[model samples]
Target: MKMVIVDKANEGKKLFRYIRTLAPSMKNGEIFMSIRKGKIKINNRIEDQGYILKNGDVVKIFFPDEIIKKYTDNDRNKYRSIDSNIDVIFEDKDIIVVNKPAGILVHPDRREFKKNLVESVKAYLYKKNEFKPGDYFTPSPCHRLDTNTSGLIIFAKTHFALQKISTLFRERNGDKLYLALVFGKISSSILISSSIDASENKENKVAVKEAHIHNFIPEKSKFIEENPTLSATYVRPLKYDSRLSLVEINLWTGKKHQIRASLAAALHPLIGERKYYTSQSLSLSQMLNVSNYYLHCYKLKINGYEEFKAPIPKKFSQILSEMFKIDAAKL
Candidate 1:
């Protein structure tokens, strides 16, 4: 199996409820039976029928590794679509950098999310007989992007690279870039140093001062955030049409939604944001049918390796040219 951590948001829920969150396809009764069979354990120890779960508790799932692997392979083939548009910026013995498109899962989420970039990458590599650890079974993405945020995501080829790249991202040494179409105009790049607070009630709120995050979401492997860190980004106006302006941004910190949150805080929320709504300007939210925002991870620089830059994906640049008659190539 797999391991699940009860996040702070799931604190008050019952153990069975928490189990349901782990695998929605399985019922509570089924989970109960599994627990009885010694398959489910709480905090790395076996759980009885009465075992209670709370926030930050580790839930270990012990089943045959082969079975879990099979489940992943089957689901990848069955659920997520195959996209030929996945752009590879660079690949070496240690790492791979790729341009992820919008409207796809970077990984599977049980919340009715579609299959994503990692699976597509695996399939591509497998088809080319390129699967390996130092050589078969490279690690999954050491980091992630938001479901609606299109950008560059890095994958590690070996355990050593995974560790090094992981540390680099944690130290905020990597360069992250995004291009966005927002509703209004700004004289220059505006960086908002806001603090994000998450309550036990699972609500996330923003504070102007630095706020420390007591992570309740216990990820198997975690990426760390330095609270009140120097989160900087450079934004330059690419072009402006009647209403929206296309801006390119490079972030200094890898906070959860750094670019999105900061931009929205500056009254330039993403052009098609539905969750983080902005009222100061018009967004594509009221416009034609679409499922994603207009931000693209145009480039990523990890550990000063700026050997190449990922060009803006077609959907993002094309939207600018088509909707506003502004070409994004000049950026």
Candidate 2:
């Protein structure tokens, strides 16, 4: 028998969703069966899986001891701890924004499960006594940046803030600006607006297909038809030489590899992007002696709320100095 109490963070959430977070090892079928068999009760009354939880509600579960043990034992200790010197860009009662460095993933995945930005945020909050283990809601990132893309990432400190910020991002109510160095000289500004279809190939790479009309729908994941979404990128050349051009990218719509794919389709890919466009002429690793790509989210703004900006990374400045004889600090 296990007893739990609803807290502020989980209030107004469905019973099934809260249970899954509590016991991740239990399958959906098992959870549904437990509800049907009266093995789970809310406020001493048998409730359906869709019942909305409220603060002060007592939840009781009756499960086998072995099943409970399976979920309780986690391998968090196996992962390496992140550095303590996390750069917090902004913080208020509702949210915390951090300046994430390059080569650090925003979240953990099966391929890379060790040090990640999310855990680092959690640890930072824990050290400040802002996060407690028994709290109903855990602070989490509202949006994500690519692993090699360095920039500002926001973390919601409360459940209300989380829901609000997530809705803002989903509705495209925010402005996101990035800086990138691409091959070839671009003299004029251009706008690339098209429908993007994305799917995982056999090599586990995200293959992107762009079209004026919606097409190329995959069976397992319908990337275009389901969402009916279109991606838009506005690019302006900031500096240009014979070989490379520094550009400012305004991302109007967010999608998987939208900027990288759009630029590559235009025959000017980012300088260090391997998956989108591998430059054979100038190896980024050989020149800069770094494996990270050269795309940075320099600025972000949420309407009527807050704005953030992150400084360009040192390696990016090094490339600019070596090629264009320009100082990044002056930009």
The estimated TM-scores of all candidates read: 0.63, 0.78
Off by over 4 Å in 1: 1-85, 132-138, 198-231, 282-291, 322-325
TM-score of 2: 0.78
Best by lDDT, which number? 2
Task: Give the local distance difference test score of model 1.
Answer: 0.63
lDDT of 1 by residue, 1-331 (tens): 7776665444544566555434444557778998888788888677676666677888777867875555446534542345535678888777788877667788766587566787577656655556521121334687878767776788876545767787887776776667787777654544444554323233353333352222232221232343344444456666765567778776655566666666666666777776555754443557644446788777776765764466666777677778767666765
Candidate 2: segments with Cα more than 4 A from true spot? 1-17, 20-40, 43-58, 61-83, 204-228, 278-291
Model 1 scores a TM of 0.63
Model 2 over residues 88-115: C-alpha lDDT tens digits?
Answer: 9889999988989888888866584567
